[model samples]
Target chain A: MKGRAEVRVMLKDTVSDPQGETLQRSLVSKGYDVSRVRAGKFLQLELTGYSREDIVARLEEICSDILSNPVIEDYEYDLEEVLE
Target chain B: MKGRAEVRVMLKDTVSDPQGETLQRSLVSKGYDVSRVRAGKFLQLELTGYSREDIVARLEEICSDILSNPVIEDYEYDLEEVLE
Candidate 1:
């Protein structure tokens, strides 16, 4: 079976985001009403697997172990079966 | 009105993504069935405006002008009404 995953890795609320803060400052100075901005990483993966259970388990491991730094980042993913 | 926007910025298909390529290589070597990976940027913005129309217009400008680069990237966003 083939699957597609959309993953998002974001900093925990306790972690400060310098890039987001800088962008917010710039936007505010430019007279935009943006109050806050948080920047993170997005990943799309295409995988081939034998079963849905296999894919789900592997994806969970990959997301936490390889894709995100668990100390400061939180990651979430949505998976769907794909025809291609 | 208060609104929240989730924006995604991704490289055009024609552009090479070295980071994604490297990650894919690493995953393959780790005995994963991953065939391809594409990495991009995710942003969550909290904005305030007088009405939905006002927020939407400003967010459109902000996304194109400040959040994403048009040269090699494409951006999309989803907006929702927020109580706070």
Candidate 2:
């Protein structure tokens, strides 16, 4: 079976986001009414597996150990079966 | 009125994503069954506006002119009203 995953990796609330802050400042300077901005990462993955459970288990490990920094980032994913 | 927007900015299919390629290589080396990976940016925005229409109009501009490089990237967003 084949699967597709859409993952979002974001900094934890306790972590300071300097990039987001800078962007907010820039946007404000340009006269936009934006009050806050947060920047994060989005990843789309295509995987091959024998079963849905197999893929989910692997995805959990991959998201935690490789896709996000456990100390400062949190990751979430949506997985769906792919016809191909 | 207050609003929030979740925005995704992705590279066009024609543009190569080196970062994603590198990550895919690293994951494969670790024995993952991943086939393809594409990476992009996610942004969360908070804004103040008079109405949903007002916010939507500004969001469209912000996404295209500021958040994404029109030549190589494309952006999409979802907007929702928030209670203050």
Candidate 3:
């Protein structure tokens, strides 16, 4: 069974997100009431030929390996069953 | 009462994610089975003085206004209640 899945990787608040901070500065310059800004990335995959566990394992590896900095970035996800 | 929240934003698969693609290439160079890699961003907010609806409203505004491109990127999130 094939399905759609979403993965989220973000910076630990303690870590300074230069990209996010840069965004904040830009948004402020653009005239918005955004006092705080933290940037992050989200991933959605239409995984096939793999069980949820398998996909999770692959995704966790992805995060730990490169998708996120386990040292500073934290990650989480959700698996949405989608139509084939 | 206030709570903790997480936001996920990513590139629409239709749109090419250069940053993600770059990361994928790097990961492959490091020796990983990452056949298909889609990069994304995640944001965690410890919102206060706001209700779920209020926070969601703000979050949606953030996504539409600056977080995710209402044009291509689709976003979603989960609210985790934590001890204050």
Candidate 4:
């Protein structure tokens, strides 16, 4: 079976986001009153040769272990079956 | 009044994604048969002193102008009213 996964990985609150800071400054210069902004990574994956359970388990493992830095980031995901 | 916006910026198909390539390599080493993957940026913004229309318009501008490189990336966004 084929499967798809969408993962969102965000920096932990304790981590500083320089990209967000730069963006905030840019928006301020553009006259948009943004109090704050945080940036993160979003991943979309296409998988093959795995059952739903395996897909879930493997994606959970991959999202936590490979996609994000556990010490400074956290991840969330959604999965669905897809056609070949 | 306050508002929130979520923006997703993705590399166009024409552009190569090195991060996704690296992640694919790592997953292959881990034995997950991922045929392909793409990575993007996610942004959450907190805004004040804007009407819903203004929020949308400004975010559309920012997402295109500052958050993403229009030559290689495209962006999408959602906006919602929020309590102070």
Model 1 pairs in collision: none
Per-residue lDDT for B1-84 in model 4, tens only? 578887888899889999888888878888989978999999989887647887787788788878899999988888888975
lDDT of all the models against the reference?
0.94, 0.93, 0.66, 0.85
Badly placed stretches (over 4 Å) of model 2 are: none
**What's every prediction's RMSD, in angstroms?**
1.0, 0.9, 4.3, 1.6
Calculate DockQ per candidate and list them.
0.88, 0.88, 0.34, 0.80
Question: Which prediction has the highest TM-score against the true structure?
Answer: 2
Show model 4 residue runs off by greater than 4 Å.
Answer: none
Candidate 1 whole-model C-alpha lDDT, 0 to 1: 0.94
Instruction: Give the clashing pairs for model 4.
Output: none
The residue ranges of model 1 lying beyond 4 angstroms of the native Cα positions read: none
Better of 2 and 4 by TM-score: 2
Give the distance in Å from residue B38's predicted Cα in candidate 2 to where it truly belongs. 0.5
* Model 3 regions more than 4 Å off: A1-5, A18-38, A45-57, A77-84, B21-35, B80-83
RMSD of 1: 1.0
Report the poorest 10 consecutive residues by lDDT, candidate 4 chain B.
B48-57
lDDT of 3 by residue, B14-83 (tens): 9887776776676567754444556666775555435667766665676678777878787777765556
Model 3 TM-score? Answer: 0.62
How well is each residue in A1-84 modelled by candidate 4, as lDDT tens digits? 788887888888889999888888878888989988999998889887647888887888788778889999988888889975
Tell me how many clashing residue pairs each candidate has.
Answer: 0, 0, 7, 0
Candidate 2 lDDT at A1 equals 88
